[model samples]
Target: MEKTLVLIKPDAFEAHHVGDIIKMYEGIGLRIAAMKLLQMDERLASIHYAEHIGRPYYEPLVSFMTSGPIVAMVLMGEDAIHRVRELHGKTNPAEAADGTIRKLYATDGRKNAVHASDSPESANREIHIFFNETEIYD
Candidate 1:
């Protein structure tokens, strides 16, 4: 099974949508291999979003991420990365499809409800960032 990382952002966590989000993924047959709630510090955020460092949205994104606690989970299933990203929908809620997580819970593009690894490489990299082998389960 492929493993991907999903982040229930601060906005969604604070809005009490974490249960609904997890249910949605579970309903789609994704299994949670590992999970945790954490408050991302600046260093972590910087490391997580290193590619976006010079972009205009970088600073705001980091600030928002560090503003509250977030749930980071490792979900395992066939095509997990693609599946998670599809469910997450477009970054802008206004542009997301109906029934998608972002469409249902995001306040805006910047505060989109969740973040998922976009590819196998990203998934592997991100999963390691949040969890070690001992933390995952079959």
Candidate 2:
């Protein structure tokens, strides 16, 4: 099975949508291989969003992410990365397709309800950012 990282962001958690979000993934056949509730720090945010470091949205992104607790999870299934991204929908709620997670819960581009790694390489990198090897269950 392929493994990918998914983050149910602070907005979703604060709004008490964790169960609903997890249900969405479960309903689609993905298994939760690892999970945690974490309060991110600036250093970790910078590491995770390193590619966006110099961009205009970087600082605010970090600030918002660190503003509250988030749920980090590893989802495993065939084509896990693509499946989760499909469920997550667009980065902007306004453009996300109907019935998608972001379309249903997000308020703006940055406040989009979920995050998923875009590729196998990124998934591996992102998963490690939030979890150690022993934390994952196959």
Candidate 3:
């Protein structure tokens, strides 16, 4: 089975959409290998978004991420990385499809409700950032 990382961002968490989002994933047959609710600090945020460092939007992105608690999850299934991204929809909610998570919950492009690893390598790296070997379940 493949595993992917998904984050219910601060905006979505603050709006209390955590269960609804998880339900969407589960509805597609993805299993939760691990999950947590935590407040992201700058250090963690920087590490998670390392590639985006020095970009124009990096600072604000980090700031928003650290602003509140987030739900971090490791979802397992076939083609999990791609599946999660499809469920998450476009980065801009206005451009997302009608049934996508972003279309249903996002407030704006930046606060677009969710984040998912875009590739297999990204899924592995991101899952490690929030979960260790002991945290994941079969």
Q: For residues 1-138, write the lDDT of model 3, one tens digit per residue.
A: 999989999999999999999999999999999999999999999999999999999999999999999999999999888888998889999999999999999999999999999888999899999999899996
> Model 1: clashing residue pairs?
none
TM accuracy, model 1? 0.98
lDDT of 1 by residue, 30-136 (tens): 99999999999999998889899999989999999999999999999998888888999999999999999999999999899899998889988888888999999
**Each model's lDDT:** 0.94, 0.94, 0.95
lDDT of 3: 0.95
Candidate 3: Cα lDDT at 128: 95
- In model 1, the runs with Cα more than 4 Å from the true position are none
Which clashing pairs does model 2 show?
none
lDDT of 2: 0.94
lDDT of 2 by residue, 31-56 (tens): 99999999999999999999999999
Question: Per-prediction TM-score, please?
Answer: 0.98, 0.98, 0.98
- On the 0 to 100 scale, the lDDT of residue 35 in model 1 is 98
Clashing pairs in 3: none
